[model samples]
Target: MRKTAIIVGELKSRYSVGRALQQNERTGYI
Candidate 1:
């Protein structure tokens, strides 16, 4: 149960980072 929770948290964090990066690229950051 604890492991599953950790994995979910990590996945969410990574997803948010990816989304932010995509947005930045759209705005000409990348």
Candidate 2:
């Protein structure tokens, strides 16, 4: 269970970083 939680957390953190980068690109385009 603990390992599963860690894996999920890592995936979420990576997703958030990618999302933030996309948003930054959008802002720059605007």
Candidate 3:
């Protein structure tokens, strides 16, 4: 159960990071 929780947290963080990067790229390009 602990391992699953850790994995979920990592995935959520990664997803948020990816989304932020995408937003940054859009602003930078424009």
Candidate 4:
């Protein structure tokens, strides 16, 4: 259970980062 939670957390963080990067690209921030 703990391992599953950790994996999920990691995935969520990575997804959020990817989304933020996309937004930045759209706005020419990166």
lDDT for each candidate structure? 0.98, 0.94, 0.94, 0.98
TM-score of each: 0.92, 0.82, 0.88, 0.93
By summed lDDT, which 10 consecutive residues of candidate 4 come out lowest?
21-30
What is the descending TM-score order?
A: 4, 1, 3, 2
Q: Write the per-residue lDDT of candidate 3 for residues 1-30, one digit (tens) a residue.
A: 999999999999999999999998989962
lDDT of 2: 0.94
**Which lDDT tens digits does candidate 4 get at residues 1-30?**
999999999999999999999999999998
Compute the lDDT for candidate 1.
0.98
How well does candidate 1 match the true structure, expressed as C-alpha RMSD? 0.8
Q: Give the Å error, residue 22, model 1.
A: 0.1
Better of 3 and 4 by lDDT: 4
Worst 10 residues of 1 by lDDT: 21-30
- Point to the candidate with the largest TM-score: 4
- Provide the clash count, candidate 3: 0
**Backbone atom clashes (below 3 Å) for every candidate:** 0, 0, 0, 0
Q: How many pairs in model 4 have backbone atoms within 3 A of each other, for residues 3 or more apart or on separate chains, i.e. clashes?
A: 0
Clashing pairs in 3: none
